[model samples]
Structure formats: structure tokens, C-alpha cells
Target: MTDNLGRGASWQAQSSQSWLTVTASGVAGGPMQIQADPSALATNTIHYATVSVKSSDSGVSAAQPVVVALWKGTESVREVATTAAVASRYTRLLADPVRPYAYAHSNSGMVADPVRPHVQLYSNSGTIDVYNIYTGALVKSMSAPGSTLGKMLASPDGAYLYAHDLAGRQLKVFDLREGQVVATWPLDASLSVFEGGLIDLIYARPNGVGVLVVSTGQVFRASDGKLLATKIAQMPNTDRLVHGLQPFRGLSSSYLAASLDGMRVFSTDSRLYMVPNTPFYWDMDYTETNEGTLSVTKAYAANLGTTLDAGLSQAGGIAMSRDGSRVLMLSAVAGISLWSPADLSKDRMLAQDLGLQSDTLNVTPDGNIVVAGSTFGQGSPQFHVLSPDGRLLKTQVTRIAASTVKPGSTGTISALTADMAVSADGNVAIQSAIHDVDTNFGYLLTFAPIRP
Candidate 1:
């Protein structure tokens, strides 16, 4: 119960059912506690009761209805029975692609193609596939040169798909609508050294300037990928290179998210960087001594004027609303935090007492709603939707794993099965699982709006 009264106000809680008990006789401008006897609940039925509150200042009284829902074993809560609907479900992702590693951990494997009615998935075998998500029909497929694919990013206009080559030295641009290869750009020779793993991708076009953010840092480019500039590199201590941010490996590290306007980019490590710099390049020196190991000293680079540290120890996910007014950040210990893009200094922690670790976060295009996927094992899997001010509007438990249904069950659920995506309309949500290295498979779930 919340206290909304001004000045000093005393209130008492009363209930008609003996199963409900009030822990305190009265409360003044604070929370009122209530206890329930779970053993007294009737099986397979929803218990209802009315709680009345009386104010000491006046004779005004108010009563609210409460509900307690109980279920039997082997039965599940059906969304259709309530006000929600399940729009789509793909049971096994590994069987269809025929590539076990395709469903493996990817910073960005599945993304809604900027074009309407189509979604893209990577096979990591030099193949890019597009399908109609609503119908589950393959629309098109194109093959590049390498079986080891990096991040797959679509152009802002949905005309082309940009990805790193197998060697991780060059960038390949595939024309999605035209169905052909348009251009391939190569990086500096020093960067050609084989760095195995997924590379983060962020495609942003704010105002009229287009920029691409990858593992190496921000790259400024035109819509056609012709005019390019290396704004930031990995090792150099140049004016544009950012310092104090450590690069990590676990799929989620080194992630990037651009504002709706594309003027700024946010990293998974709780740092924001400005994009669109002048075309220039610089390299740092690395020497191999008799020990056969490379040695180099770090240098302090010039700090960019536009940078904000949100104070997250390790940010797992970051997202910005379509209007670029609000931001959502998710970390292991801090739960979820919301910040105002206009002034990030003014921020608030949302659902801190949830007692669940979140793996991913997404906000609606309009900046009105935010959703987060919880860690699988630490607690029951759930998706939390909240308003801009951190008010929780809904908590939808995604699933009950086999292990949880019956301890010591046959199959175990991966704690990394939590991934979320919100549609542009803000009415539909698609939740899926990504292989967490040890597991070789994943599943997908979709939710449509009946009413919010």
C-alpha cells in the first residue's frame, strides 16, 4: 500500500476475511503491511476479498478488491484465458538451419530487417537468410565468401546488409532488395590479424549523417558506404580514441546502441560516445621481444567532450527510444535503470527489489514503455514491462523450465535463454533464446497485444 496523503495522516486497514491479517494497527505517511495465510487458500479457485481503509483525520473510508489465483499441477496459465495472446512460436532453431553453430551466442544474430514484413538471421557459413516472420517463409538468401560471419547489420534504409568478412579484416555490403553484392571495404593492413569471435554492429543515421560502429570503434560513412572515415581504432591513443573502457569477450561485452537520431552511441560498459568525426587514421606501435610476446605501453588519449558514465559496473544491455528522449540500461546487480537522454544525470533505478538478474532490455519506440528479460535460473523467468517513470505495468513469466516443473527433470534450462525484442509499434514483443556456448539449441516466443 502507498501513502498519498499530504501533511501527517494516520490510516487503519481492515479486512472481512479471517485468512487475511493486518500486521499493524495503523500507519502514518508510510507503507502498510498485510499478511496472507497461503495454507488457507482453496485449491483451483481464485480467492477474493475487500480491504477497507479508514482515515483518522476525517470519516472518509475506501475499499479495494484483491485477488489470489491458485492453480493445480500439470496446468499452466494460458494467455488466451486472460487478455493476452501468443502470436508465434518456433520450437527448435538449430534443426531448420542445419548449422549447429548458427544458433550459438551472437551479439546480434536475429534482427528485424529495416524493411517491413521481413526478418534476417545469420547462418555464420557465408549465408544470410531473410524470412517473413509472420508467415515463417524464406524470402531470400545470399552467400558471401566466409563461413565464419561476424555481426550482420542492415543499412538504415533497408537497402543493404553490412557484415565483417571471415578474416575480420574487410567489410562486405550486400544489397538486400537488389540481391547482389554492391561493395566491399578493407581495413588497415595492421588490423588484418585474425581476431576470432563475433563483432558488435550498430548502424545509425541521425539527421542526415550515417555512421557504423563495429568492434574497432565508430566509422563514419555515407548512405552508399563510399565515403568512409575511421573515427576510432582499437590500440591507438589518438584524439578520437576513447579510453578507460575495457573490452570483454562474453557476447554481451562491447555491445553498442545508437540514439534514435543517431547523434550518439552507447556502449555496454555504461559509456556514451559521440559519432561522425573527420576522416583520419593513426596507428600505435607494438614490438615482440625475445620472450616472443608482444609488449606495448598505454598512453592517455584526449577525452571527448561528450561522454556520460551511468555508473553501471557491467552493463549487459542498452537501448534508446525512437525519439531519443529516454534510455534503458540493464546490469547484473543494478536490476534496470532509466535515464533521460536530455540530461542523463537525472536517472532512476527501476524495479530494484525484483530480486532477479536481467540479461537484456528494450524500450518502445515512443519512449512510453520499457521491457526487460530476466536471468533464467536465479529466479523464475519473467519479462517486466514498465512505464517511463519506472512504474511496473505488467510481469509476464515467460516459462516454467522442465527442471523447475519437476526437480531432477530430463533436460536443463540454460541461464542464458533470455533475449528480448520490441516491435516499432510498441504493441508486439518477441522473446527468444540464444545458445550460451555450452548449449547447441534455442527457442523463440512471440506475444501480441489484445489490450495493454
Candidate 2:
């Protein structure tokens, strides 16, 4: 990097390949160098590395690939070098979600710690797996004597994990760093008396400060699992905004989306609730009126009859933006729809033609961009980046071993498993994918948006 314009210029370099390392990370107004070592090759082969550069002034970044050829003690009879068009579509697999058990293993559990880079994944075998997203490595797994694990929640500071043991009727909090169970609280004995059994424990959530057990209607301090409140409906009244936590019965929502603070919540059931950040609570249930009509009612708010089309179903997912300004509804088979929280009016529809069929739609913490995974249909566009105004900005694909698609195929011949997470800045993303029959395993991928 150089400062030819006489103004201060700073540059940072990152290496995409393991064999390559940035000798000089942050070089300002001078020469920056990267080192590569590939002398231990047993056979002649070519290795590639991509070096990304970015200045401190702008979010835009650039990358260039460095190719090197290595050979064994014997001279190579043939040498082949390939050059592929390189955009900022840099995606790399971190690792398999669960390496030990890959056969018929689906990621049934996942939660990101609010304050740390730690991500907890639940496995089918009654184990809670934890991984550090920043390091791209599996830290550890926590399991108990029971096989029926309900829902898991992380503390705000990423120091603890609260998990519900439905079989044992207990809530356990683990210290993430030590990988040890710190506290355990027995569930309400009356819970087992419910007609639906103990499965209702699945609606548990851990606010940064305390854990809210929806099934049992109890709140526990996140630090020690101490009983904070017996019932969520009976919390001490305060003036601050209380985080609204409501578990709708009989609504089989496959996915649940909530604010980072764990306050506001919405599901595919078409119901949205906002809880006061303090101890107050408010919940609204969206009910089906007719074959194609829906209506919402509030117990406290009189004269409030809200209705909408019964288009929302299990095939789609709903999300409330971080800013609480917009609500996004998504279906991989369908397209995208945005609505206003104030009046439930349609705001903007990204249209199914754009291939917005992602497992979920996530808005950046700043609420600037809406990111979602894309499949083969609709021009085979990859993950899409949408501006606040709902304009397409960038389209990127995971860098994985993909099978060749027919000239015109309707299905997703090569598509991601629809699992992804975007950074708070909306500049980078980490996604999972399973590509090609040769490698029928899932891989974690990280990439940045290709600036136009």
C-alpha cells in the first residue's frame, strides 16, 4: 500500500488459503508482503491463495489470487495452470457441524450467543454442541443423562448456556468457557400434569439477564439459574420496556425469530407480540377467520380488529427487523414480502422471480441490508444482499464442490442447505452447504458481499 496522494492511507491484508499467511497484516503507506510455503508436496500439483485488501476509509475491498506450482523430487512431465474469474465471492467451509455422526444427521439445534462469537448446535443424540464462529472451530459439546433436549438459550455475555431437559423436567445452565454445568433448577411439578405432556418446554428462551421458560412459565437468572420469577405473567411491574415472550399453543411453527434482546417474537403462525423490556407483557394471536382470511385479536386492546389474507403457512417463515420498522415474511418456494408493524400493511415485495427462497431472512443489526440464501432457480442466483429500500445489491454463491446443472433445469441441481448467518455489519456471512454426491456432507462456509 502507498500514499501517493499525500493523504494518510492504511491497508489490511487477509489470506484465504491455509498455506498462505499475511506476514505484514496492517501496512500503512508502505509495502505489504505475504508469505507462502508449499515445498512438502509429494506430487506435482498447483495450489491457490486469495489475498484480500481493504482500506480503512471504505467498506469496499479487493482480492487477488496467487498461484504456485510445486513438484516432487522428480521433475513434472506436464504442468497445467488454471485461471478462473475471481470476484469477491469468497466462501470457505469451516467444518462439518457434527463430524462424528454424519449419516442421517440433521442440524436440529442452533443458537448464537448474543455477546460472543460462540454458536451452540443441538444434535439428535441429546448433545449440545458449541462452536466459535470467529475461529471456525468446534469448542466442545455438553450433554446430560437424558436424550430429550428441548430448547437452548445463550446468555447475553456468551458466558453461559441454558438448556431445557424435557425428559428430566429441569433447566440446566452451563458455563460456556469451562464446558461444565453450573446450575440446575427443577421444572414446576405441575408442568407434567398438563395434557400436552412436557413437550411444551420447547418454547424456552434466555434473555441476556435471565432465562424465560415458556412451558413452565418461570424465569431464572442467567448467571446462576436462580429462580427469578415463578410465572412470566406475574413479574414485578416496572416502567421499562419489557421483553414480550409468548408461546402460542397448537401453532406448529417450524422456526422462531426474535429480536437480539429476545423481546419481540414472531413465527410462521402469523402472530406477532411485543413485550415491554421491563416486566410488562402484551401478546396478539393471528387467527384464521375463513378459508382464505385471518384476523388478530388482543385481550386488552379493545376495538382492535386486525385482519389479513391467510397466505401465511408452514411453508414460509416470518421475521421482525432489528429496528422494529419492518416485518419480513419469506418462503423458499415463494418469494419475499415486507409488512409494516404499525398497520400490518404490505410494504414491499421482492418477488419470487428474484429467487429469495432462503431458509430464513436476516436483517443486519443496523437494519441496512436483508440477506438470504438463493438457489438454482431464478437465474441460479446465489445469496442476495438487499438494500434498506429493498433493491438488490449483490449476489454471491458458496464456494463448494457443485454438480453440473443442465442447460435449463427447474430444480436446484446445486443449492445450499439453506443455513446461514450474517455479521452485524452486514458485510460478511457464514453459511452451511452440501454439494455434489462425492461429498454428501455439510460444510460451513464464510464469504463477503461482492461490491458492485
Candidate 3:
């Protein structure tokens, strides 16, 4: 504490709450120490207290009040259940925003329907199989020829299923309720250059679906397969002097994420790009002939080496909190860092020096907890649950007993290919352990009531 008038006066501090104690009171213009005892605090509650400092000098008019807040997080979660082993491992997992259901996408070409809380959709060749998500019971089967269900995304209302047809180089929209392919639009010709390369697609709210390949971004109407806006990376004028007027097309290999409101799209190479003015165009009707290029605002350099290159080939290393308050980037070199989506400002580091390799990143819908999975050079897989401001709440390691390990295996767990998801209410978290070599079987592990 410092005195306002530069007068070094003796000051005494008092705490409003019993849990908060002032360790040392000193003269103004010096330092004082205070501590908080949360042992007796209730879980999942935020407690506030004030420390009033009164100076002995009469020149100081009023007592200066310092506010302190303490939050007692929910109790740590313990492993509750594990699903039966299956031949096909799920490479992708997601939790529904409004339902108590989890979607698991198997490597054998099965994807859970995001709209239907209890239904799973599997596409083998041209046949679509619908099954119950929980019971593994077959609901119905339908066939749609010439459609490949590679990398599917559901519309906000769950009315349409947007899928990429790699073989045909087209984007197909399937009506979930009708169980039929309603529309098919050819992808941008420029995307063909990335033929076998990484391409990302995300469903933005307010009826916009963004397709990002490297630095090129295209927005389409979710209601129909109409191309709305196309944006190319615009290097700064300083960079143009060195590289000429050519557009910087290769910003990132594949990292892509959008905000909850669908107003902005984020992509990163070494630097972060918040594609500006996305909602303005999508909110209006712009035909292919009338469509114009979306403006580029600014690009922020995160200074983290190879931001999302390591262990992020199949899984997205970039994610936005459900509340759209924070944008998270998982780096193998720098751990997990949080940024403000509003301005692309570095907020703070949530966790650092995670390991040699870190991959999966996710945030609860309420934006309170963040979960990430990492591995230490073929060691047992570990997952960390953390608060928004960098507090390590819990860490769990997946270990298999030596007797349970598969023969000829090293018994080490790898999270390089793992995927994780936390429920909307922050009560449940699920992780897919398909790449665990010790257990040749693929399965889902569940951690329930993770938050109060």
C-alpha cells in the first residue's frame, strides 16, 4: 500500500471476513502482506472481503479499501465409468450444447448425430446407419449413393448435416429429419490445391458455415449451399514490400475456429488472424456474382513457436470458450495460452511447459474449466483440468496394469491422437483412448460430476 500524498505514515489494516487475515501491517508507502484461508470455505462459491487501511496521519482523510476475491472450485472428479472395448476406435468426440449426450466419431466411419441427442450416424461407403448413442442399438438404416460422410458438421438447430465429399470435391448437406441429401455444392476450385492437405470446416452461428484451407477462408450459408464471402490473408504493407502484392495464402496448415456468435473466424499460422466482418456479409444475401472479398483487419503474432503444428494434425489445437470470452491455443512448445477473441490480445498463460507434446484442448460451455491432454515422450497419458485463470484443479494419468497390457507392448499410453470433450453444464468430461497401444481395444472413459 502507498500513501497518496507521498507522506510515509504508519497504517493499520483490518480484514472484513474472518477467513481473510492481515499478516503484517506497515507504514503507508511500504508493503503489507495478507493471506486467505479457504479451508473452511464452501465449494463452488466466490467469497469477497475488503481490507481497510487507516493511516495514523490526520492528513489522510479516509481509509483506503482493497478488495479481494477467493473462489473455491468444485471438488476434483474421479473416474466413474469406462465403456466396453470396441474394434473401431473413435477418433473424434464432442458434447452437445443443449443435450446430455456425447458424440463419438469412430475411425470405421461412424459419426454421432449432433442434432439428435440419442442417435449416432454411421456411413459405410454409401449407406447411412443410424444407431442409439447410449444403447448401441440400431435405430434405422438409409442409403444415399455418391455421398461420403467424411468430416461432418451439424447445423445449429440440428436440421441439416453438412459433410465434405472428398472424392467428389463437393460439400453435401443432408437433411437429418428427411434422411436424404438435399443439396451438394462444389468446393472452391482453389481448395483443390490442398488435395491431400489439411482443410477445416466450422458451423458459425447466424447461418454461416466457414471452410478454411491454409490462409484462405470461405463462408457459406447454412440454410442453403450459397457461397457468401471469400477472404484471403492480406499481409501488412511492410510485408508486401518484401513479398510483393501477392496474397499470403498459406497462413496455417489447418488450425481454424470460430466464435459462438459466428461473427468472427480465427486462423493461425505463426500469427493469429481474426477474419473480420464475417457476420456483416452472412447476415445479408450476397450471391456468387455479387460476393466480394472480406476485409482483413490485423494479424497478431503469438510468438509461440510452431503454434499448432505438433500433435494437431487430426485434432484442432485451437478452441473458443462457449461464452466466447477466451480463445485458447495449445502449443507443443508453449503449453496452453489464452487470448481475448475481441481483440486478439494475449490474456495470460493458462498452463505452461505441459510436455514435449500436447494435443487436445477443450473448454466447458460455461467457460469455467479448461481440459487438455498431453504426453511425455511415450509415457502414460495425462489430462489436466484447469480453471480460467491458470489454476491447476486436477490432473489424471491413464495407466494400465502390466498384466492388462497387450503382449509385446511397452505398456506406455499415448495421447497424441486422443480427443476430449466436456459437457455443457461442466458436469461431465469424456476422452477417447483409441491410440493406447497397451490396450489394443478402443474405448471411451468418462469422468462425471466434474463441476458443481
TM-score of each candidate structure, all chains considered together = 0.53, 0.51, 0.58
Of 1 and 3, the candidate ahead on TM-score is 3
Model 2: lowest-lDDT 10 consecutive positions: 96-105
Which digits, one per residue and each the tens of the lDDT, describe model 2 over residues 59-164? 3233222222221224322111001111111121111211110001122334544434334555435565544443334556666545445555554334566665
Return the lDDT, model 3, position 311: 16
Candidate 3 worst ten-residue window by lDDT: 275-284
TM-score of candidate 3 against the unseen true structure: 0.58
User: Against the correct fold, how does model 2 do in TM-score?
Assistant: 0.51
**For each predicted model, how many residue pairs clash, with residues at least 3 apart or on different chains?**
1, 10, 0
Which portions of model 3 miss their true places by more than 4 Å?
1-86, 107-150, 178-180, 192-197, 206-216, 234-252, 270-316, 356-359, 376-380, 397-417, 434-452
Off by over 4 Å in 1: 1-108, 187-198, 233-253, 268-310, 340-346, 355-359, 368-372, 376-380, 397-416, 433-451
Say which candidate scores most in lDDT.
3
For candidate 3, the lDDT comes to 0.49
- How do the residues 253-291 of candidate 3 rate in per-residue lDDT, one tens digit apiece? 445677664556565442222221010011222223444
Q: What global local distance difference test value does model 1 have? A: 0.44
Q: What tens-digit string does per-residue lDDT give for candidate 1 at 337-365? A: 65555444335677775543443465664
